[model samples]
Target chain A: MELVGISKLNADYEAAMAVRKGIKLFIDESAKENFKKAGIEVAGTKVEMISDSQIVIDATPDGIGAKNKALYVSMKKPAIFQGGEDADVAEASFSALCNYDEAKGKNYVRVVSCNTTGMLRVICTLKNSFKVRKIRAVLIRRAADPREVKKGPINSILLNPVELPSHHAVDIKTVLKDLDILTMAYVVPTTLMHVHALTVQVDGNPSKEEIINALESSRRILGISKDSKIASTAEIVETFRDMGRIRYDVPEVVFFEDSIHSSNGEIFLTYAVHQESIVVPENIDAVRAMSGLKEKEESISLTDSTLGLLRGRLV
Target chain B: MELVGISKLNADYEAAMAVRKGIKLFIDESAKENFKKAGIEVAGTKVEMISDSQIVIDATPDGIGAKNKALYVSMKKPAIFQGGEDADVAEASFSALCNYDEAKGKNYVRVVSCNTTGMLRVICTLKNSFKVRKIRAVLIRRAADPREVKKGPINSILLNPVELPSHHAVDIKTVLKDLDILTMAYVVPTTLMHVHALTVQVDGNPSKEEIINALESSRRILGISKDSKIASTAEIVETFRDMGRIRYDVPEVVFFEDSIHSSNGEIFLTYAVHQESIVVPENIDAVRAMSGLKEKEESISLTDSTLGLLRGRLV
Candidate 1:
């Protein structure tokens, strides 16, 4: 896979350089020396990369990727944009769980944001088994990635929009077009994981056991820490380390099994999603999906298997 | 106010005796020597504590409190039992926010359990704001008190009832008889606080701003960490410490402001209740109510004011 090394911010540049091994990264002439010093193999401009490659994954910082649309369209190559890009910027949105069928052979795909992706995974999984009426979620979001020190209030809690449903609900609509959801979001100071408190109302009042069984049987939805020992999200992060995951990336929604409660035909639960790698599996699925190389099931299974999804306490 | 501490477990005895400067304590003959060495004052027997007091607060173990019912009735002394006691054992169940008037002048009063107390506090506060149709909650419970090391699985998640709706729902019924609530409980290995994921469905679809306004206006619900810098419960605890709270105890439910979401007439949010001090103000209110010392508002205001509830980020 080729990378895009834009010598913009310190963090983005360093991130690209760190993962530059065995991949040809597109960079400007000014960043060639820095790339060489960092032992990174450099390629040509974004135009050249688009022309040479069969498909392009636009990971450039938000608006920049969307602005490069004309280049990809001129080359007639399939393009995949990161979640940061606007949904309208892409031809259609893709989540491995929600819209996998529609994603196949797509020329352009915008993978949903991390929170939307996590919610979609659970909602899509459960909607097949139960009659989902509505979804209400409160997102306890991390302020920034661990390395993004320059990107936070550092000590204050600020509400995005400070009113109404946050943009997350609107963003999710790009994938699950018909699903009714209302989301509230808050960015906390910590850079650990995003915790979501979700309430999903189904048609009939099911037993708690039934809800747990359904959620547990779902794909990529991990029922974690049912035992009394593993307590907080902090302990969960430690558990991920114990499992020896690459970069301690848990690519699934870590939900508390005992917290899955069904009453009056409604389900209430809490889950923590590791924001860093939650999108990695979906990105892999999108690649196969856009290339039309594999069917939905085959692509998901291959991606999950390659990412060690079924190996341990994770889904 | 006099405290009647009974010497039983080593920790309980030490706790009681350490604070026995002006208080009377009841102890068995076997533990009398330990109390004497600890420079604690020992009163007559359990019978004497029940006989001499204007109101006997039964702090005994669960079933034991019910077992001592005859002694309290024989003396015609009004008694208050902790939540561990059976609800039927008391003349009326009491929570500061719910049925405080009914609790007054009752000979036997049973305060709701910690989980029930916390739930009642929120439910009673919100019931009037909107016509609450149903409440679905997932209780992330603490395994034991911080000092009670021998009382937990230590590293295992244990589900109480292992089925739909734990005893908390039943207990809450003791207070809010008409409330439609379903609660599932799990004991995690942490003693910090009990976090609840709550979903409330009301009559007409209220706006997110309406819900936030209702909750913020309610008593003893602290909207904490409005800034991104104050992140997790750990940092919230640190904030409490910085505020110079006694033992860093936050008597109210600390909820993230940005996480309050309302859609389709349903509200979703998460809040952490400090288990240790959650009931402290209630106990004070209960005492005043039972003694006929003050009206409900007077008692609650006095209790809140005396506990420094109004001075900090709470109440």
Candidate 2:
């Protein structure tokens, strides 16, 4: 909830106020109340300077390697790094996953790779389990702005850009390398949430009910049930005018009414996940799990219904 | 090259001028062409006339047994019986396929259902040969025509009177079943061709090349190939002078392209094949294939150097 950094957004005062809510002011002297200068430490790092920030999520653009490495090394504690298109990163730079247990005692940790984090949280739950068999995903994405390159029905992305999707599959491949996984990703024209079309071939002829129940057990997946619900802003997304950056709940198993065939005995289950929120659930929980404040369960329940709660393995 | 039929469609009216160079015609006032009224002399327990020109394709459209049995009796020599919705057609109705070899002296042969036909063709192709573990096909189609109550893409059909693209998958499916064929069918906007999206899981890792090749070989499959040739001309169709109703050379294939991913992967081969042409290729071959035949081939060969004959398939 505490927003920080990128003190100067090179934006107008009105634009800055419109984008922020709390109006916190811990940014560099040049930064206004809304934005902050990312003070990344280490002399040669991409960030201008590093401060004693508790949680440093390096949201850097693609294609930066050595600079980010220096930032991570400069950290007193492990830090979370996000390199959007550069998800195919080196593992040695970040892997607090195993140490989260010990680090939690110290109240700290670092993360790397958004794709790896998001896919891992969702896919890990599917791995170490037999209920999952195959995976197919398609992302309905929009450019950040419309003046951008043309994307399939995108909301807005300004530059003429080559929208991408499959690149994440490779990043995910490396993240889940220890576990057997396979993924197929596609990009659509949308802004934030990446909607995914998923298919899971269970070990046997498991009834639809069983599949639903398995999905309900994963903390990363949301299966429809009495207690389940799409995160609220969605309940109010229509209310906010100019709320162009809003997103739907991730792992929301939407029924593609267009692709269902009861006569043929087959169906393709689909979902959408916000890139920003993808790590929120796991990041909060990782601190707890590493600190021994939580018990190791077989799976985490993220949905309301029990129908196929496992975020099905990448394959 | 000869152009002989009940109608000398491609020739000039030289007959009236007493010329010998024109094609021949076999004219008769009463003859059966539509499958149902075709003359079938074979008599069996299933022999019974259900309607004047229309034979009950199934035992019953709404209720009981193999109504198509009536087709076995009404056909002139051999005719096709069909089942729409959930009608149960007798396997015996597909006898035409099984006994085609014996047709040296026999009269009729029956066959399987349309969905079954599409299913078999896809599963038996080069991609699977028993190497595939499962296959799922989603067939989104339109109603055949308006004379019947169409149950699909409901709102669109109600407002506009357009061509439909349903039932195209039946033939494709019938030709490739047994590979865990699960199909989903839809009734879309036009009365043209059926659209389908298929995913097949084989023994090995899925490959794009193999999938493309498998689809290319499916005679009923359209809209695929390295050339993005739009292998069929369904899209370019319009009201033309000579042809009464325009269609694709491979309607099933063309329809399939509409069902699968578009924009990405791109359509390499696509085009329309006149429906009448499917039934009259031989006659057209005599006229056009051999067009300006002998002399043209000689001149083309001399100028083409070699391998020019291969261009026929391209044209």
Give each prediction's DockQ, rounded to 2 decimals: 0.10, 0.04
Candidate 2: tens digits of C-alpha lDDT, residues A96-212: 222234334432233444444544544544443444554443332322332245433221111111122245555555444443333433222234344433444445454445444
Residue-level lDDT tens digits of model 2 in B147-197: 344543322111011111134333334333343444333322334333334
Score residue B187 of candidate 2 by CA lDDT.
Answer: 28
The sequence of per-residue lDDT tens digits that candidate 1 reaches over residues B79-190 is 8888888899998889987788998788788988777887887788778688988887767666667678689644333445444677898899888888888776655555
Kindly report which residue stretches of model 2 are placed more than 4 angstroms away from their true locations once superposed. Answer: A6-20, A25-52, A64-78, A83-123, A126-150, A153-169, A188-210, A225-276, A283-315, B1-121, B127-133, B137-179, B183-315
Best DockQ among the predictions, by candidate number:
1
Per-residue lDDT of candidate 1, residues A232-257 (tens digit)? 56667778888788788878877777
